[model samples]
Target chain A: MQSIIAVSELSKVYASGFQALKSIDLDIRPGEIFALLGPNGAGKTTLISIICGIVNASTGGVTVAGHDIRRDYRVTRAMIGLVPQELTTDAFESVWNTVSFSRGLFGKPANPRYIEKVLKTLSLWDKKDDRIMTLSGGMKRRVLIAKALSHEPRILFLDEPTAGVDVELRQAMWEVVRSLRDSGVTIILTTHYIEEAEDMADRIGVINNGELILVEDKNELMRKLGRKQLTLQLHDPLDTIPDKLSAYGLELAAGGVELIYTYDTQGEPTGITALLGELQQAGIRFKDLNTTQRSLQEIFVSLVKKPA
Target chain B: MNFYAIRAIYLFEMARTGRTLLQSVVSPVISTCLYFVVFGGAIGSRITAIDGVTYGAFIVPGLIMLSLLMQSITNASFGIYFPKFTGTIYELLSAPVSYVEIVLGYVGASATKSLILSFIILATAGLFVPLQIAHPLWMLLFLVLTAVTFSLFGFIIGLWADGFEKLQIIPLLIITPLAFLGGTFYSIEMLPPVWQTVTLFNPLVYLISGFRWSFYESSDVGVGVSLAMATLFLATCLVVVWWIFRTGYRLKT
Candidate 1:
């Protein structure tokens, strides 16, 4: 797939000597949902700001849709849409006017029909005539999304789009995002919610301490680091592991009423067959057994916890 | 040039002025009328006239300049500052519009507002005192040049100010006092020799002098020097604004 956005050796250092981002390089594939996951103050916003042209990068180069960000700002910016982290809208402006004005800012000719479609897609058509300040918080966020989509950008950046949103609204927003992506807009979102990334992202980038520590396909990252636990309810209690099954790494839990076995999914044969035979030979009968795979959240926590 | 983008921002700002009619339009007009009443009515009865023009007519240019300076700064500064305050500036900064286009939209709207106020004040002054324009074209030239110059200055202040209080500081403390002492109500020639020389150092004096000359053909300084000073101030403002956009000072992180 062709890269829609590219960043090479990007870095940002504020006047106060605080380095918000280190030398970083990234490429966003066309027609893909790329999720950038990070903890608080992890430079996710700084990275997004540079690409959106809201903040100047201290050093580096970025190109969007084959146009250099610095040299061809208008061209690059017109190809991108940004739903910023803040809910900033003109209080007195009607929703219709605000969205239409945003389209004009991109130097696009006025198209009321396109504007109407964008508003309707975000479910904000009913409130189009209402002043922005009168809308609910969720409705206001929808308006921001409508404005971002007004110019028919090829790439959209959602910076913590669901940070303060309620669960029902967040799900609704996710549906809207999915539909937008289905219509061919490449979406890049920065979020701390591992579940959100796991559910929606095709690929995930984990940023920590001004660095991107990992970037991989969502499924691959999970399968590579994911571990499984097999829990067995014992038919009878036991004091400890029997000598015959001492080779297997098994533990007694639930006060010896259960046996727990942990193993990597990628490990050799998972050791399940041999372990099961050993348990049977040792006369350790199981009443019930269940297996659970590690969630993406756990993998993320472990990745960020490793010392650089 | 992205004329569409410029028009979008310009219309948005002008729409804001309409929404705040009581504060933007009515307030300035009422305040200037009061200045005409107190100075042109009460003071005119005592002084009669200054430099052959009636007291009411003599101060007309100065009063217009005073309101122009204040309104231009206030309108432009607040026009940009409110977006910064509300955090909507990020949207604009990320838009495809260039810095020059953004400045043109904002400053253009602000200058238009000030010009409208000046004409309204001019009409109000006519109701109280007979008015004459020795150089009608020059009068308009001065009005437009001064409005555009101060509006640009206000754009700089808006970009530089980080707080609401900072927005009002320059117009209230520096520009207002300078206008008052810049011979708005009285000619600097009436001052002592030493004070007259000192008053010449105030830039507002040149603006008021050149503007008054356009109206009554009377000025504290030579008309050519006054026009030159106004142009110089305008050039300086343009340079500062250019630097702000280039360096992204207080605009980009």
Candidate 2:
């Protein structure tokens, strides 16, 4: 149950004076699917780049399983795998050679059986002998995954793993991730797809403007941040909210044909009962009534905006 | 760095420039034959020998060295630059390999290509004019040194370049012109005293002079000085490259 990856006060500043990461501190647990969500240029990729040893951090250090990434780089790097966002591969090389070569890069001994298994797991075995340039975009991506996993790393970093990929391939990738996780591989994924994280991540970390704003269990974050809205389809058109309805923060909607009431489910009382009673006293009646709950998508949008 | 990994990377790169085998092994032979036809066959009718050596034979070493130097720099520089421009460098950078492995693998392949081209050019030159190996050992040593030195130089150039065009600038504009002006087609001794002194300043002169001296017994430069100059040039290049790798100058950041 030790932290598989740790970052303390890490920051990255580019040569153009752009602050890519600012005072970030977080730790990822072993064998957990940790998804980092953020908008483009929000330092999610930068943070991953530093930990993957592809880019140098302007300040601070990161460690993988107690090995300092910069000082003990070989040991740290050997223990981790990174599938970069770019579709970069040896175009003229066969899928088999590319994955086998990648495994060799980690100083792993030749294991054709393992390479074949990785290719088959990614659905790339049939295309194993085909040149990389001839493969489709999704197939090439699968090859990158096979290459990343060929070395049998304990931790894997997939940066935007499903970008430009089809739904079927993405689902397949998710299954691969799940299997890897089941086998005790710690996964730190950065994705723009909120649903991908919402569906798969045990814990979610949201980063913005080079800062990590929040990290919490998926269910806990959703329950704590999610809000519900109560809607009333008024029987008669109301010109404005009544003075008595001021106690409840109800918003008139659809040109007075509907009223929407927002409240936290975690509150002592949602107050829908009291609001309905007050509406009756104020001569407010609805033809139909329903309530809708907020999702992680909404909470994410709100968190990205300035605190209000 | 794992040796097998380096070998794998080297073979992978060799495959990368697969098309270059045509250009490296074939193009140089064709180019040398053309040079022999126009410069050696036609020009030899009037000019006999520069200094007791046939004009065709005198320029043979220069022509071979010319292609070797140019091919070495272009092959190595373009080799690295294309991968960077094409975004394949990210795959390499993200791998669990070290920068040392990358350099050794790339430069090793480049050296192999340069040697291959150099020897082919030598054989092509033999078809036109005979070569006198006054000191076969020194000749072989000089060829190896020149190939390795320029290969390392080109590897650095490859890393420093940002674009495909940038990779060609040094060889097309600087190195080629320097080779011609350094008296690859002519002898410095024929020039006036001031021009001869000026030719000494060009680094290519030392390389070509050493190469030519190895073939001719009555050469002006000594073997020791030639080897020393070549060694110093190579050592300087290695140090700069090592420093760049250490700093990760334009690479990581």
Once model 1 is optimally superposed onto the true structure by TM-score, how far is the C-alpha of residue B221 displaced, in angstroms? 1.3
Q: What TM-score does the first chain of candidate 1 have?
A: 0.95
- Of the true interface contacts, each candidate retains a share of 0.87, 0.55
lDDT string for model 1 (A1-308, tens) is 66899989999998899888888888999889999988888899999999999999999999998899999999999999999888999988999999988998889889999998888778888899999999988888888999999999999999989877889989999998898899899999987678999999999998988998898999999889878899999999989988777766789999999898889889888889999988888788999999988888999999989998
- Model 2, A56-77: lDDT tens digits are 9988888889999988888888
Candidates' chain A TM-scores: 0.95, 0.92
| lDDT tens digits by residue: candidate 1, B48-151 | 57879999889999999999999999999999999999999988999988899998999999999999999998998899889998998888988998999999
Docking class of 1: high
Candidate 2 lDDT score relative to the true structure? 0.85
Clashing pairs in 1: none
DockQ of 2: 0.53
